[model samples]
Target chain A: MSKLSARSEDYLKAILRLQDQKKVVRVKDLAQLLGVRSPTVVGVVSGLKEGGLVDQEHYGYISLTPEGKVVAETLLQNEELLRTFFEEVLNLDSGEATQNACNVEHFITPRCRERLVSFIRFLEICGRGAPKWLDHFRHFSLTGEPPPCDRCGEIFPGDRRGCEKA
Target chain B: MSKLSARSEDYLKAILRLQDQKKVVRVKDLAQLLGVRSPTVVGVVSGLKEGGLVDQEHYGYISLTPEGKVVAETLLQNEELLRTFFEEVLNLDSGEATQNACNVEHFITPRCRERLVSFIRFLEICGRGAPKWLDHFRHFSLTGEPPPCDRCGEIFPGDRRGCEKA
Candidate 1:
């Protein structure tokens, strides 16, 4: 199948979320959730129907085809993962993280996503009770420079570049 | 200014790169570089001209206005940072990193960009001679489980969950 546009993916994801929250989804529900008009929802839903991504039945109730469900679920997963990474690992505020995740979810590739999952997992395991290096990282973020110890050859003797390696 | 479409940003970035490499830019050169046709370039260039992002004069030679150059430069920097993060921090192959970087750069926000910068800087500083946690991460990636030491209460005493902290 061809890749769905970001707008289409948003519709799919919104539809899936509505499906999760309620038994029946109407045009107005999706439109309200997406902050668009009913006519706009009608137009996009028809396109999605043509694309085999959704089914409209029973007086405007919307349902996802199996493939559509899969696509929507994947995008939802990507969005959640990005939100977690941004909020937990990147330490951005919840709103900032949500916004960034929404922007990035469609664009991040599967390989990058896999790597991200692993990075988070690594932190979960290796950072039990929060590792000391994490504090060092926080310091670096605040100062825009590595701390005095991580800067020189102290950590790795004879590697003189220190924090200036870049 | 309003946000440019991804297509418009592509045109602007392509112009910047071509400008960096040579003195003059034509629609054909842009089309060749972008692997699109000249007519498409002409159409988009007209829109960009109206937006004050570019100028087409002296037989189709293209030049970015100051604002256009700033926008293009920011996009270029975002792309490079993403490429470096994917390649160095994520350990993705060069080609995969480049492809993901290209897909992600336009959508990433300035705040998210700052976090990514800090993350890379953290790695550069704290990961001198490769942190052991990163090695554990590599192991986790290959085996889909943290190593024995990380899985128990060894790293952090009384923490029985160990690698299962998630």
Candidate 2:
């Protein structure tokens, strides 16, 4: 885990995504997805095979080994979790959140990942499958005002504050 | 931003932290901080100088240029934000969260960073400078149980679910 480079992790995750998309992951497919040359993909695939994380036949489809499946699935789950966090919790655009989530999946430590999973569960099951503040945030984003009035505890449109004397 | 590698970002951040610690950043200091050899640091420092990111006197102290200062400060702030999110928001240990924050700072895009900053601010000011769920989570962790009985909202130890018919 410590020795894996970000590049390799990206490659692995890319392969997993391509597979999910019903694409047979070949060197050319990897190259297109990763924006690298086919030769580079071939080299990295060879390295992945040597590490026993991937299995490839001669000029054939690339597939994850059993051990590789565990790693790839965990990475995919991490990316999905982060994407949800960014898009649902943070109110980011879907496309931008997905891209950022992919990059973040490689760097997050296991402990942080566990904490996030628990937090996400807590958020989902706590009341209405979302926090109260999340609704307030959505309102604030649309109105460019604070969530409710601080003094009166009422949602406002930024112009009316009941307690102006304070 | 797209052209920068994770390694170079790490080097820039290391220099910034060392500088903040009031240490004279020479090639040797960078090498020690980065766990790389001195010659590797020298090579990267030369590249940084060529890019006008760092200014180095001949065999003397290394310092960031204005452009470099901006980049380094942004990275440091991103790291700090993430650390706070993990530690304050997620209740992770300080040392582990700080280390994870360092790795996360490099991969987060500007858009995501902005969202995170806003989210952290929201968490800080939402109710009592922390979300209501955070207290529930702390209690849950201490007792190794869910936050209160589902039916009555009463805190309980594990195995004490009041609703057995559901």
Candidate 3:
């Protein structure tokens, strides 16, 4: 598949979100959701239509093609995974996690995204009720000092760059 | 700071990388690095110059302004952090990690980047010489069955979506 620009992907995602919430999508709704002018939405939607990712009525409602739906779902899945990682693991506020996830979603490749999914699952399992590193990360974020690793003799702040070698 | 398009950020990063390796940045070099035509590089560089992010000596050599250098460094740092995470923690091949990191760097916010840095440090300290989850992730990638998390009773493939609750 050809790579779409990040902005174009954002448009696809917004269209999907608007459709889900309102059960219909229009140029005005897309513009409002994306915080852009109506003309910009019109232009991008027309481009998406030409690319066979969307369909539109005669100057009316917009809808995703099957291909577009797949693209939107993938983007949404990535955003959700990242948001969950940031909020649950990193302990970021929900708003910050949502914003960061939105910003970062377009960049993750399918291959990398698969690994991320598995990694998230790993964390979920390991983090349930044991000596979870997720909590350790949250503590480090709060106190700028990472908890010591008994496995490795190197202290975190003291070793700093040398930690990479460990 | 005004937001630049992903394209613009890519251009800035390309120029910085070319300058670091070749000691000079020309339109052709940028075209080759970005896999775009010289005309595209010229157009983008012109916009960069207009935006006060770059300086071109009579349409010959291109160099970044001080402001542009700051932007480039931030992008570079994000890429490095991601590349290291992918390669070191996730065990992706170096080339794949670098490529994915380049694609994803511009989207990470500064605050998120700081957390990532700390997270990497935490992993380095905790993962060394131990039954590290980093190695466990590589195992999951290969076997497709995640190593069990004794704390949670959820098995990965069987409880795909429900793993989140675990």
Q: Highest lDDT: which candidate? A: 1
List each candidate's DockQ score. 0.34, 0.26, 0.27
* Candidate maximizing DockQ: 1
Across B1-166, the per-residue lDDT of candidate 1 in tens digits comes to 5869988988999999999999889889999989999889999988998999898784758999998899999888999999998887778899999888888888867778898899887776555554544555667776777566533332221123433532
Give one digit per residue, the lDDT tens place, for model 1 in A9-106: 99999999999999778999999989999989999998899899999974659999998999999899999999998888777889899888887898
Worst 10 residues of 1 chain B by lDDT: B151-160
Ranking by TM-score: 1, 2, 3
| lDDT per model vs. reference | 0.78, 0.73, 0.76
| Tens digit per residue, CA lDDT, model 2, B86-154 | 998778899989988988888777878877777766554443322344677565544545555452222
Predicted complex 2: DockQ: 0.26
Identify the runs in model 3 with alpha carbons over 4 angstroms from their true place: A1-4, A148-166, B1-3, B50-53, B65-67, B148-166
Q: Rank the candidates by DockQ, best first.
A: 1, 3, 2
Best TM-score among the predictions, by candidate number = 1
Better of 2 and 3 by lDDT: 3
Give per-model TM-scores: 0.84, 0.83, 0.79
TM-score of the candidate numbered 1?
Answer: 0.84
